[model samples]
Target: MGWITTTWHRLGSPRWFYGMMAPWQTGFGIAALVLLAVGSVWGLVWAPADYQQGDSFRIIYIHVPTVIVAQSAYMTLGAAGLVLLVWRMKMADVAMVAIVPFGMAMTALGLFTGAVWGRPTWGTWWEWTDARLVSTLILLFLYFGLHALRQAIPAAESAARACAVLAIAGLVNIPIIKYSVEWWTTLHQGSTFSMRRINMPAVMYLPLLVNVIGMYCLFGYVMIARMRTEILRRERDTSWVVELVRRPDVR
Candidate 1:
């Protein structure tokens, strides 16, 4: 317990955390690239086509993964918010800001791909009444709102606190998004992966699992890189940062 507490405190140090993440970033980045590439190719070519939707269903490989990542990212933001509010961890705030853009992008991609998939399946590009769709758009807006709030506030501490409050409040939407299909009438289907049973076939789901894991790796890689940048920016005036930057291999 003592060691764990000490380690946690050590992680709060920007220099130590940055140095430690270097190897993690490299490993996860390479793994993400390889897994994503392989999974994408396998999903597009080798995976069996859907009986009804056929080739169009292949989009799920990207669509589902992106939506999953988006939701998970928002949850992470909420967790960071909690850390910031309670522990006042600067790294937590950095993490929250660093992940916002990626979360927004994932949400956008999910919506866009859903629309593309919907065009043929539902015969419409947009469905305003769909609970899943509407709720997800709201989630995107939440990301936007958070980002806007951060930029609008000049003081770092104030901005972090404000964003933390918003993030914690916005967590209400996650459960709503998850249970939307069941809670109300909607065109959207229930979860593909469930604890009770697998809803998809092995061939199709295997590649999807691969892509999901790869996407997670990609998210971790990107978040670490972004957090490092945020740390550098925030710590620019600190002696450790100055010394690190002066090193020949700093970049």
Candidate 2:
């Protein structure tokens, strides 16, 4: 318990986290690039076509991974928000701010790809009444709302506090988004990984898993990179930042 508290406090330090994440950022970048490239090739070229949807279903490789990581990123944002309100950790808010942009991009990608998938499959580009689709759009709007809120508030602390409340409150939508397919009738499909077994064939499923992992790696790389920059911006007046800039070895 004591060590846990020490480590958690240490993680709150910008300098410590900045240095600690250096190697991890490189690893994440390399892993994401390699995994995504390989997964794309495997999913697009080699994976068997869906019996029903044909090659058009190949977009699942992109669509599923994006939505999966997008929701996961929002969950992270909500957790950071909790930390911000509870412990008043500034680093938690730094992470909350950093997560919004990429999370927004991922959510947008998911919605766009879903619409593309829907065009051929359902013969429709958009479905307003579907629970899953509506919830996902709301998720994207929440990201946009957070950004707008931050910009609207002139005071940093006030913005953080307001965003924290929004992020936490928005969490109810996550479960709604996740289970919407089950709870209501919709064009969206149910869970891919069931409690008993996978709903997909092994050959098709493997590449999707790889891309999902790659997307998560990409998310990590982006978040850490942004957080590092945010830290530098926040600590610009400090001596360490001045010394860091003077050092030629800065990466």
Candidate 3:
């Protein structure tokens, strides 16, 4: 417990956190690249085609991972918001900002891929009445609104507080999105991956598991890189930042 507390306190220091994360960022980035490359080839080429959807079902490799990442990113934002509001941690604010763009991109990609998958499967590019589709679209809009709120505010602290409030409020939608398919009639299929039972075959799911893990690693790499940059920008006037900048060995 003492060691854990000490490490936690050290992590709260921007300089320490930045230095510690550099090596992890590099390791995760390389792993993400390799895993994503292998997973993509395996999923798109080597995996057996769907008995019904055929080759088009391969898009699931991209779609499922992005959607999962999108949801996870928003959850991270909500947790960061809580930390910023309760503990007044500047690192939490930086994390929230760092997560936004990636979340938005993933949400957008999920929507696009869903639409492409829908066109052939559902006979329509979109369905307004589909609860899952509507909820997911709402999730995308929430990301847009959060980004706009962050940018529109001029004062740094005020902006962070406002975004934090919004992030916390928007978390109500996450459960709605998750349960939408089950709660209402919709074209969207039920989850393929579940803790209770495995709905998909091993051949199809293995590459998907790889892609999901790779995407998560990619998110971590990007978040750490962005957080380090944000910390430097926010703490440029601090002594540690100044000394770190002057050091020849520090990259």
Candidate 4:
């Protein structure tokens, strides 16, 4: 209990948080590369072709993981925003800025792959009226808004507050994205796998599970690395950062 409490307090410190995440970066980074490779190879080469979509269905390995993680990454932003608002932790704000670009990239990738999958499946590359599609488009825009907000405000705390408010408010969109297919009559299918249950066959879902885990590890690795870099920039004048910067090993 004491150790947990101490660690929680130390987490508020940039130096402590930076050092604490070193092992997580190494572990998750390596897992990301290995699992992504294994999952991609297995899904593409071994998984049975769909009766309906055939080889085209293989795109789900990439599409599912990217979209899942993109939604999750935005939730991370919302959580960070809450922390910043309640605790005024600058590190939380650092986390938000760090995740925005990555989240945006993932969202874009998901949309692109969805389009590719749609072309043959739906006979259309883009559909502005689809609930799932439109909600996701709005998500991407929310990320863009946060990025632009950061650039618009030069004052650190002021930017943090504005971004925090937006991030918190944006939480509303995530659920809409998750439930869009069900809430409206949409072409998109409900997800086939969840942590609580797998609605897919083992042979097909196993590789997807691997890719999901890999994508999450990749997110962790990227987010932590970005936060570390941001911490150095934010705490440039701190003694530990100065000392670390001076070390011959770092150079």
Per-residue lDDT over 1-251 for candidate 3, one digit per residue giving the tens place of the 0 to 100 score: 79998986787788888889999999989999998999999999999999999898999998999899899999999999999999898889999989999899999999999999999988998999999899899999999999999889999999999999999999999999899989999999999887898789999999999999999999999899999999999999999899988999876
What C-alpha lDDT values do all the predictions have?
Answer: 0.93, 0.95, 0.93, 0.93
Which residue pairs clash within candidate 2?
none
> What TM-score, over all chains together, does every model reach?
0.97, 0.98, 0.96, 0.97
Q: Which candidate is the best by lDDT?
A: 2
Q: What does candidate 1's lDDT look like per residue over 51-82, in tens digits? A: 99889999999899899999999999999999
RMSD of 4: 1.1
**Model 1 residue 81 CA deviation in Å:** 0.2
Candidate 4 lDDT tens digits, 1-251? 79997876888889888998999999999999999999999999999999988899999999999999999999999999999999888889989988999999999999999999999888898898899999999999999999999899999889999999999999999999988988999888787875698777899999999999999999999999999999999899989989998999988
Candidate 3's TM-score reads: 0.96
- How many clashes show up in model 4? 0
Q: Which stretches of candidate 1 lie over 4 Å from their true place?
A: none
Best of the two (2, 4) by lDDT: 2
lDDT tens string, model 2, 1-251? 89999999899999999989989999999999999999999999999999999999899999999999999999999999999999999999999989999999999999999999999999999999999999999999999999999999999999999999999999999999989999999998788876798999899999999999999999999999999999999999999889999998875
Under the 3 Å rule for N, CA and C atoms, how many clashes does model 3 have?
0
Give residue 231's lDDT in candidate 2 (0 to 100).
Answer: 98
RMSD of each: 1.1, 1.1, 1.3, 1.1
The backbone clash count of each candidate, in order, is 0, 0, 0, 0
